[model samples]
Target: MGIELELHSERPTWTESEVWHTSRATLLRGSYEHGEALEQLLTRLGRDSPGGLGSVDRVGDTLFDEREAEAALREIPGLLRQCVHESQTVAVHDLATLLASCAATPGSHLWFMGD
Candidate 1:
């Protein structure tokens, strides 16, 4: 579960009531303290409760979307190229060369270079 925190930056300090309301809102919206929410969710699932099926998969899908993964994959080569171009010293060059060599080896390191 995730939360959308609306920080009241303009306020000098949050009142006790405001803090209580915010915490209540967060809990209502499925944000958990530590793994309590997940544990509760699993317990509910074992009992075949409707709450177990609510909002979990949607949140997970949004977090692990294909487009986001593709974008991260595309950025790696550009990052490596930038590192090589910005290497001004011998040590930096050596590090970049080592990285490039690792990147070239078949299945030696995880390279998600997508087409």
Candidate 2:
């Protein structure tokens, strides 16, 4: 459905300095129809950031990045995947929410549709 990126400063809590980017690609395979959604997500992430922590911006094609976004993205997917694989009754909303959170932060990108 959609992916989001969430950033944090220390080990746990996200501060105002953190960024939140998001990308929502098409549900159909191979169609990257959600570019505007991704752009808007990035813009929102930037707006949420505390001044001097750097900027949140969209990158070429399907990439979005922020200074602190990258680190969070690196580990979140694996955790999600693990949850998906390990749990039989995993909540769809929870999974989607996790995906969105993962996609919104830095270094997170969505492969929507066919991608």
Candidate 3:
């Protein structure tokens, strides 16, 4: 049980036979350790209920559509500088990259699956 961030061409309904199938691009697969290390940053980003990085449930799921992704993309750089976890630096960078891709694509969405 961990956190997985995926980039999908469109909003996923999760009714697909294979959740991790070819419809999405796995951006980040973070273990409990990784999630713990980045908790501060995630919390600061905002809550998933408000279309931010922090998922509503620590073990549930959240989705960020193109607009939300763009909003996140704007804040990531400043938030990253405030991050103190060296181990999570790369993870955050990857997130920023994926967010950028999601923002650039018209109907793309970013999914945060946590468990």
- Model 3 alpha-carbon drift over 4 Å, by segment: 16-18, 21-36, 44-51
Put down candidate 2 lDDT per residue, 22-45, tens digits, no spaces: 111211112223334433333433
In Å, residue 28's CA in model 1 sits off its true spot by 54
Best by TM-score: 3
Q: Write down the worst ten-residue block by lDDT for model 1.
A: 3-12
lDDT by residue (tens digit), candidate 3, 1-115 = 3455777777765445776564445433222345554555676655543436654345777788889898777666676797776866866777777788888888877776666
Q: How do the predictions measure up, each by TM-score?
A: 0.20, 0.23, 0.70
Q: Rate the local accuracy (lDDT) of all candidates.
A: 0.27, 0.32, 0.65
lDDT of 3 at 71: 76
* The best candidate in terms of lDDT: 3
For lDDT, candidate 2 versus 3, the one ahead is 3
- Greater lDDT among 1 and 2 belongs to 2
